[model samples]
Every structure is written in structure tokens, then in C-alpha cells.
Target: MEVETINVQEAILLESTTLSSRQKNEMNVMKTKYGKTMENSDYLEKLEFFVIDVIKTKQMDTLLTLNRTDGNVPRWFVTGFIRMPGFLYAICQLPRRYRYTNCINLFIDSCEILGMICDDVAGSRLSKVDFNTQSDEHWTLFVQFIGVIYREGNSAGFKTKLIRTLRLINYREGEYTSFVQALFKAHSRIVVLRIDFEYQKGIARTVSLSEALDDLDHLVANMRNNAMFDHMLGYIFKVEYGVDRGIHIHSVLFFNGARRNGANHIGHAKQIGDYWQNKITLGRGTYWNVNAKIEQYRQKGICGIGPIHWQEYDLQVNLLNMVIHYVCKEQQMIRSDAEPYRKIIRKQHFPKINEVRRGRPRTIMIASVSDQLEVESI
Candidate 1:
């Protein structure tokens, strides 16, 4: 597939009316609040110092805290980074809650762009940074670092894109909810599975984003015809480009729960994952069995995988809110030069209306009492 690379700077300037008046007003309020507090010179100076310190000491966690409210960074500043070319990619590499040092290398690379750290120093700063310790000063400077990146990266353009991107995210979320509802209506129960298809670290660095996407598209097309997916009900796939992971896909597969007969959902997921790894991509790809980690999600109270009955309202809600929403979120953030409304999420195999049978038609019977009375009169 020929993938078009969007020029981030140019795309941000495109006009969009996706946000409602209320949303626009709210954004204006947020911008005004932050604008009054920090000047460009101060923001840049703080950012430079913060980057230099983090580079020298390798304190990456201080950078992570900028996303939190207690970190003292403005909300707009944090949100603005979402539109930065590779910011989301780096953020995705970080472990949840920033508990570990997964993306320190990427962080350093991003910092290098600011010209705050010398090229020679960046290579030596690859050691792990302790996420558990942070001083008050670090927090203050980290906020400045975040604010500077936004301000220097063209704050006005980022804000415009942020508004448009948020509106697109909301609209896509609604579509996801509706899609899930339709699946439930068509089938009494669905065996939901989540699988992540990604390239090996070395392979990821070797291929272009478009090439990766093409390989994934081919794999998915073949899977549809494969016997393993014979009873498939529906599926959704999302392509994301990350700094570390490169081009990858987050996918959800829906199958006929009755046919599965409450079988090992994780096992089924493994088969698909293995197919992507060994057969489809021919060892160039690796897959993560998201269902295998069900317990983790369960502990967090967001487990939405496994066989879910249509009548089970809570499970259905969880599936829609947690699973579906996740796959559909950040769709607007896809770095594509094609068009503003290009669809990054691919959905297919939905049950047709006529194919679905809902609780067999109710039987009706009428007594002929009037006929009996007429016979007696005769």
C-alpha cells in the first residue's frame, strides 16, 4: 500500500468545524487561563533547564509527571503535545502510570529536537531512570519543559488541531458504541478477543510505516478466509505508528459464542496471535495475546474480553466502554496526509440484519368461541 505522509505543520493549519460552539468556548477559556500565567521567554528558559537537568541526571520520571495535575503543568500544554509529530508515539511506549523506564531513549531523542541537550550527551544517557523518586523542583521544571515544547512548537496550530482532533475522537467513539450494539443485537452471545499485531523491534526499524500497514492488511484478509475464523461474527482493527513499536495494529475479534461453547478464549486468541507471528508475517511479526492478561484487566475492573452474553448489561457496557472505545480512540491522531476525515479504524464482518434470529417468532393462537355459539343456534 502506498501510504501518504502528512506534513504535520501543514495539516495543523487546515480549517475544521468539527467542534461545537460550546466546545469551542470551553477551549477558549482554557487557552485564556494559561495565556495569562506564562510568557514565551520564561517558558522556553524553564524548558531548556529542565531538559538539560534530565539529560545529565537521567531523571525521566520527572518528565512523566507533567501529564498529571499535581505536576503543575497547564492542561492545554499537556493536550497540545498530542498533536506534536512523534509525541503520542513516545508516550505510548511508556508503561502505564509511568511506573518504569520503557521509553527513556525515545524521550532523549525528543529532547534532542529542542536543542537543549548536546548530541554527544544523549547517547550516554541511555541508562534506566528511577521512576519512584522526584523532588519538588523537578516537578516545577518538568512543567516548564512541557509548556516550552507546546509554546515553541506553534501553540496556535496545536490548539486548532487539538480541537478538531477531539471532535473527531468523540464522533468515532459513538460509531464504536453503535457497532458493538449491533453485534449484540445480532448474536445472543459473542466471544470477544483482543490481539495486538506488531513487528519485532529490529524488523520494525527496517520497514516503512506504509509497508507495515500493507503486511497487516494482507494478514487480516487471509485470516478472514482461514478456517479458524469460519465462525467469526465481526472484527475491528486500528493501526498506530509509535516511535518504538513502529507500525502496529490493535485488533478485536468477535466470534459466535455458541460455537465456541465457552472454550478457552485465551487459547483461541493465541492461535490468531501465533498465526500473525509464524504464518502471516513469517516471523517478521509478533503478537500480544491481550486476552491472556485478562486477570490484570479484571483487577482494574475493566475486563471486557471472553464470552459475553447479550443479556449481561454490565459486561456489554464494559465491552463498549473499555474495549471498543480504546481501539477507536486517537483515530484522529493518525499521521496521514490523505485527508482530514480519512478512516484509520477498519471494521468488517458485521452480521447482516436478515442473518440474525432473535428469540424465534412468538406463537399466536385464537379461540373460536363465536363459531361454537353459531353451531349451537343452528
Candidate 2:
């Protein structure tokens, strides 16, 4: 299988529109108040529509459409690092209330709108879940939306003139600070790498535990050297759920490179697997789907979340942040020095461990052996 380079530039930004019903309503309210309010009403209206409503609606639509589950991620619902001080900054600066019902309503409405458009475009009824389950594709779309929002929020247009009156919540207290923090601490860097693997004709195609471990070790070692060479503190480790079976890794490294100054080397990183895979191999008579690589881990069964278990995902996300932080600090990077990427380095959290288990085993034994390295940079 040949891995194609992911063009970050190929990211598609949804058309920016100023025609939201919510925005129009707010405009009328402002006009009724005789424009006497001290609030930066126009700016507030845009932020609410663009960032809060649009992003949330897109995410909710994907989740509901794919999972067929129907609980809203309320503005007040802190999804991990999003709860930190940074989120507070966002809320206060935008003055967007984290109302539960209103947020859900907006999400459902967005889904309906998308559904209507999709139905018309395809000339068929839009089924919530297709027979093959395109959940992964939907997830990719959601991630793209995230990328777009990040791009816009970080743009000079939104930051300079229009939002001058806005005092964004400090990165420490932003709405999604926990998630941001979990991902971007001064010391920890999220490294995503992609690798292509070719199987020896029909042999079971999968990576073994030792291979996964070796790849992780190599990445960490290089990360350490990079940090040391630059005379910066470095911490490095591969994050994984060590289940004594086949393994997957989420490696985080702290490097003291010039990245702290303002270089954006972040994304689905490609360097890790590039060194391992030489010439790309094309599959004969068959092609590989990108999503299969992400879901190849053999697992028996995992139970659903109980009431208490519901928070486990959040806990896991938080733990990941701590682990990355600890590793980076161990390597000598100071958290205080990460001011440049503060907003980009979100403090997000996952659910707790016990909450994730919810009493079901998530293990499936696979005796089959294949020769493919199913890895991607996250």
C-alpha cells in the first residue's frame, strides 16, 4: 500500500456566510435597543455564529448522523482541557452564554439543514447510517471543520479590527482549554505520522507489537537528541493503552527547536514513517481504504458507558495531557515559555478510564498475521 502525502493546504473551508437566522435576530435586538448598548454586538454576533454555533453544529451533526445517538455537547459541558482558564477567556470575551437547551437546538437545526441539502443534492432520502457505516468519513469531515475554525480564529482579520473590543479568555480558561492544553503544553508536542505497508500476497496484513514499540522508541530517541542539541528542555514518550496485545501508539515529544518562536510544523506529521518505508508499493488488483488503517486493532467487545462511566473519556483526555506534560518537563522544557502557541496548544481532556470500560471488554484476539504497518501520525 502506498501512503499519499496529506496536503494541509487541500483543506476545504466551508463558504463563509453572513446570513444566519440567529445573527439576523441579534441584529434586530441591537437595532431595537437604539444601538445604545455597550456590547460589541456585531462582533459578538459573528463570533457566536461562526465559532460557537457553526462549529458545534457541524460536530453534532457528524456525531448524531454517524453514531445515531442524541445527546448534545452543551457549551457548559467541559470536554476535557476545554474547561481551563482559556475557555473562560473565550466566553467572557465573546460574552456567549453556555446555555444547554439553546445550544442543542442550534445543533439539531444544523443537522436538519444539512440533511435537507444532502437529500436534494443526491436526489434520494438521506439515511442516518449507511449500510457500510461511513462514520469514519464523517469524522474526517468533522476534523476538517476543526481545522477551518482554527485557521480563521488564528487569522489577523478576526483578531485586529473587528474584535478589538473582545477580550478573549486567557488560553488557560478558554471554552476548550482542557483539550487545547492536553494537546499543546510548552513541553509536549503532538506528533502525527503516516506509513504505508505492502503485504506479501494475501498474508495476514498487520503490524506486530514489537514493531510498534520499536517505532515509538526511535521517535523518542530522536526527539531527545533534537531537544538536547538546541539546549532546550525535552520530554518524550509514546502514549498507548498497553493491553498486552497488539499495540498502537500516540507519541508525544518535547523539543526545544525554534518552533517556540512561531514556526507551524504541526499537523499529520510525516517524518516518522518516512524513514522506515522506502519505495511505495501498489496493491495488485485491489486498493486500500484510508479508514481501515485507523481501525485495524483487534478488539473483542467494549461495553457502553454507565452513568458514572460517562465521564471516562474526559478523564483519559486529561491523563494524556498530564503524561505529555510530565514527559516534556522531564526533558527540561518549561511550561511558562510556551506563550507563542498558547492558544493553539489547547488544554483538552478525555473521559476517565473506568468510564470508558463501562464493564465491557474492548479486546478481540487476532491470531492472523499480516505484513502491513498500520500506522498514521495523529
For this target, which candidate reaches the highest lDDT against the unseen true structure? 1
lDDT of each: 0.55, 0.28
lDDT of 2 by residue, 238-278 (tens): 32211111123333322223233213222222332332232
Query: Per-residue lDDT tens digits of candidate 1, residues 1-378?
Result: 332233322332331245566544543443343232212222222333333333333333444544333333322333233222223222333222111111232244445554434322322222121111123443354455554543433346544644565565566666656667767767777899999898997766455545666777777679757887868878888876543465678899889898885468998899888988898788989988999998898888887889888777767778877888777665212344433233447777744623647575422121111211111100
* Cα-lDDT of candidate 1: 0.55
Q: What are the clashing pairs of model 1?
A: none
Cα RMSD (angstroms) for every candidate in the order listed: 19.0, 24.7
* lDDT over C-alpha atoms for residue 239 of model 2: 25
